[model samples]
Target: MSDATSLLTVLVTSPRLPAGLMSRDAWTALEAAERVLASDLEDPLPAAIEVSGITVTALPYDSPAEAARALVDATRSGSVLWVGSPDADPGLTDALAEELTRLDEPPQIEVLVGSWDLPGARLLDAVAVMDALRSPGGCPWDAEQTHESLAKYLLEEAHETVEAIETGDTEHVAEELGDVLLQVLFHARIAADEDPGFDIDDVAGALVEKLIRRHPHVFGDGDASTPDEVERSWEQIKATEKADRDEDDLLAGIPVSLSPLLIAEKVLTRAARRDIQLTYDDKADLGTRLLALVAEARAAGTSADAALRAVLRQIARPATD
Candidate 1:
């Protein structure tokens, strides 16, 4: 077909986009390829009318079928049939997908974009962007960040995510979650860049696998109704997982990095798990013990927590004297 005939056909075949809603880039690219058609479209396009500068022929179809018919009418042979971003409407996208599956000569070079899994997909994108910015043409800050240098940031972002949740701010939580995602993506990018084996996909897949593996009660046949049942199931799964790795003792999993107070609480929790009489009495007796501790701390001219910590420390490392 001649270039003019082919160009007209291309416009006819192109999807009838919403009037005045098309992106500037899309219009510009169309005009660059076929200026006459773009100009015709630009004149009447209600929403994107200002894009008359875009110089594209606009299809006057109230319906998509009419738009598709225009495509058939305008074209005789090979031409570019620019479909707008296919992933725009869920229903329309499904119909288009079904139509594509039925097409005899489906448009080659047609690209797909976007997905339901946006957050995960964005992480993948971020890893790629991070790598790009750290490579030869990459940003200096990103290029200079080692795993160690970024550790504090990763930890901070995670804490921010927790704080957002604690504050019950949905918007802040969303943004903070993104910050956490950034750190995760950055680390994955660094890993892939340094080792060539680890990437954002691997990081995500590992987390997905771990969650599914751990939640056998949810994902598998085992059903748990209560929180206690859920916890029991989780511990059972955890024990099985640890046993597979030849690690025993649930308490042994606690990190040494835990602060002394936190470690004490955790240790006491584990001890309480044994049903031992560490607390010497009931709720009343427990309050009495706590009051006694407060009195002892007061006698030492210090706060209860501080006084306990001081006594624990002295006993922990008794001086040679």
Candidate 2:
């Protein structure tokens, strides 16, 4: 190697991604290097590099200090590239730094990120953890959970997430959101173990398909300039999707499991969308009054369920002297 090209390159790649998937710079550095070394030749990245017709020499050093000395010695003669271990080659970088300081003319050392994790990569970790917990000889409590048994926890997590958002603590909200996600992953894992055709991927795929189908303005050429127009478009798309169900009933598809306030809001919204005027008598019962309050809250663009929850929280607070 020439004077300018004589260097030590520490190449790191994301273990989560395929070994051969690397940046152009990484491949260029590998091609330019006089020697490419790895502690283990059988490791995925080294093996992949070998398949690409690049010679990857295995360093036989038993310790990081010894490996560091060998790397520095190689770099002094010519350009040398060290493939980082999946476990981050613990203590190797520190050992290299110490070794370099003792030398009068150490080769220029630089860390190169060959590959990085993409967005939502940590979701893979969540899936793996859920699988492990539910697997045999794993967590006994997690192993015993079923969808039906875990349903209440899902509802609780959602409510907690709502409360966390209301408090305006972003960190708390994120934590609560994680709890909600855990329920989803847990249920998906259960389904995967028992139901052959269903998994988290199926759930996510259906959601993605539904989002694309519904948002015609965004995904297709359909025109919807305003939020109201977009919402109307969604309702129309949903109606068409549910054409096999009873089309005559305006509230046919609204989930019955929702809180009474939310149920009332959905019913009122559905009725308004259909241009069906619904009225209550002057001598309306308590249920009718509650429904009317929900409608009032909806008209004011607020949640009656949240309003009631806030008042209850206030009442439950310990009195200050």
Measured by lDDT, the strongest candidate is: 2
lDDT of all predictions, in order shown? 0.54, 0.89
Question: Model 1 shows how many backbone clashes?
Answer: 18
Q: On residues 19-91, what C-alpha lDDT tens digit does candidate 2 reach at each position? A: 9999999999999999999989999999999999999999867788999999988876688999998888989
TM-score of each: 0.50, 0.88
Q: Could you tell me the C-alpha RMSD of candidate 1 in Å?
A: 15.7
Model 2: lDDT equals: 0.89
lDDT of 1 by residue, 1-321 (tens): 233434321222212333544445544445554323321333334224334554334544444454444454344444444333222322433444454456554433233221134243444456666778878877889878878999889878876786577557899999998888778777777787674468777877888998998777778888888876776677667777777553324346776764444445554444434444353333566656664455444446555555555577679878895
Top candidate (TM-score): 2
